[model samples]
Target: MTWKVLLPVGEATEVMDTLYPIFRLPEDGFEVVVAGPEPRLYHGVMHEIPPNENIPWDITREQPAYHVRATEAFRDIRPEEYAGLFLSGGRAPEYLRYDQDLLDITRHFFEAGKPVASVCHGVEIAAAAGCIQGRTMTTVAKCALDVTQFGGIYVDQPVVTDGNLVSARTWHDNTPFLKEFVRLLKASVAPK
Candidate 1:
């Protein structure tokens, strides 16, 4: 059977974070299903620290015009039908973490012992969904506290794999994270 992976997208979704896996997964034979608060196009953003800029912007203030549309809604997802779940990063997670529907979908993956991968701000979703307790994971430094606050051990590394969950600090780490994540995913679907 073909593998299907759920990618929960949202407004202000980091462009790199959202797109890399979308393209990579399909190349590996996993169906990429884009989901969101609602089934429609959502804005994506490019996040960078302008070299000359010296001020930090609260995510809400750094909005750029990038966006990605979701082909489906979190409320409409059947988590059991997918092999894994991917939570992308950026300002989106700052708000999306509060979404009950998204939380439900997140719980589905963890509760089922499925392969789950998250990067950067994606840790917020796991924290909010209460899935991080006692789990070891990693994310962009700024989000380190979120994981620990939720009772999960936060590691600083390019990539870290704990049981069925795999994570990276940012898109720069995508290469290794995807390498490890795909391996874990394939193992999950391997013939028993």
Candidate 2:
């Protein structure tokens, strides 16, 4: 049987963070359904520290990237119907945390112990959902407070796995975190 994964996205969602799993999960037979505040096309952005030393910046630079189409709306999502959740990162989370519907959906995955993958600013959603408490995870250093502020432990690493939740600091750490997430998802469905 094919398992479905819910991915919440919004305007300015990071393209790299969102694309990797969307394409990779299908290789493992997981169908990814992008969920938005409303069902529609959302703009994505590229977040990175420019390679040129001419511009010294402390944080990532965001450039408009490809668009992501969210076929499902958060209000229309039934968390119980999906086997896992994948939270992508970007500036969107800075605002999306206020979404009540998305928060409710995020809480269900953690409460149910379903596999979840969060990267970069994605931590904001999980944090706002009240699901980060007591769990250790990683996200962009700037977002460490999202974990700690919500009563969770913050760690800096390529990947951090706490129970069914797997997280990474950024898309740069995607390989390790996604590997762990895929493993968790597969294990969750393994015959008991």
Candidate 3:
């Protein structure tokens, strides 16, 4: 059987964080479905602290990059149809946290014990969904509160796996992040 996964995105979704899974998941035969606040094209952005010889910026610099289409709107999603949930990080989650539909979909993955992965600001969505409580995970240092505030334990590391959920600090950790996510997806399925 084909394994389907859901990726939630919004405007300004981090290109690296969002695109990595879009391509990587298919290589392992997991069909990736992108969902957003609406079924439309959303812009992606590059986020990084540009190298500076003098004073360094405290936050990442954002510049527009590519576009990713959301074929499905969050309100239309059927969480049980997916085998996994991947939340890509970006400034999007700052507002997406208020999306009731997205929050509900997020909760389903955790409630069902389906494999879930999150990176950077992606944790905000999960935290808002009330699914992070008591779980150990990692995310960009700035987002550490998203975990602790939601009664989850936060760790500073490349990746953290607690039960069916896997998380990473940022896209830079995608190597180990996606590797572990793929393993979890494959293992969740029974042999034919």
Candidate 4:
């Protein structure tokens, strides 16, 4: 049977963070189902530091990029149908965390011990859902507080895996993050 994974996203979602998994999961025989607060196309953005000969930006800059469509809405999601969850990062999580339905969906993954992957600000969603308490994880430095404030141990590493939860500091760490997450997903479905 093909396994389906849930990917939660919203406007301003980082392009690389959102698209990589959308395409990569299929290579492992997993279907990626994009979900959002509502069913529609969300505006994605690219984030990078501006290199200047005279002045350098202190943080990543955001620019409009692509539009990704959510195949399902958070309110309609049946979390049990998904074999895992991927929480991509961007400015989106700054607000996506406010949606009760999204938080509920996020909680189901951790509560059931399902495989979960999170990158960058994506940790905000899990933090808000109160799923990270006592879990050691990593995220973009700026979001480290989100992990600590929620009672999680914030590791400043490219990737950190705590049981079923695998996390990366940013999209740059996607390779390792997805690697570990896929392993967990496969193990979950392997017949004893």
The best candidate by lDDT is 3
lDDT of 3 by residue, 38-94 (tens): 999999999999896388989888999999999999999999999999999989899
> Model 1: which ten-residue window has the lowest total lDDT?
56-65
Q: How much is the lDDT of residue 168 in candidate 3? A: 99
Instruction: List residue ranges in candidate 2 displaced over 4 A.
Output: none
Residue pairs in candidate 3 whose N, alpha carbon or C atoms collide under 3 angstroms: none
104-143 per-residue lDDT for model 2 (tens digits): 9999999999999999999999988899899999999999
For model 2, what is the alpha-carbon lDDT of residue 123?
94
Error of 1 at 108 (Å): 1.1
What number of clashing residue pairs does each candidate have, in the order they appear?
Answer: 4, 0, 0, 0
Clashing residue pairs for model 1: 41-69, 43-67, 44-66, 44-67
Runs off by more than 4 Å, candidate 3: none
- Higher TM-score: candidate 1 or 2? 2
Q: lDDT of each model, Cα atoms only?
A: 0.89, 0.93, 0.94, 0.93
Give the true-structure RMSD of model 1: 2.1
Question: Tens digit of lDDT per residue, candidate 1, span 1-192?
Answer: 789999998888998888999999988899999999899999888876555447754442355765687999888889999999998898899999999999998999999999999999999998899998999899988889999888999999999988888989988898999988889888999999
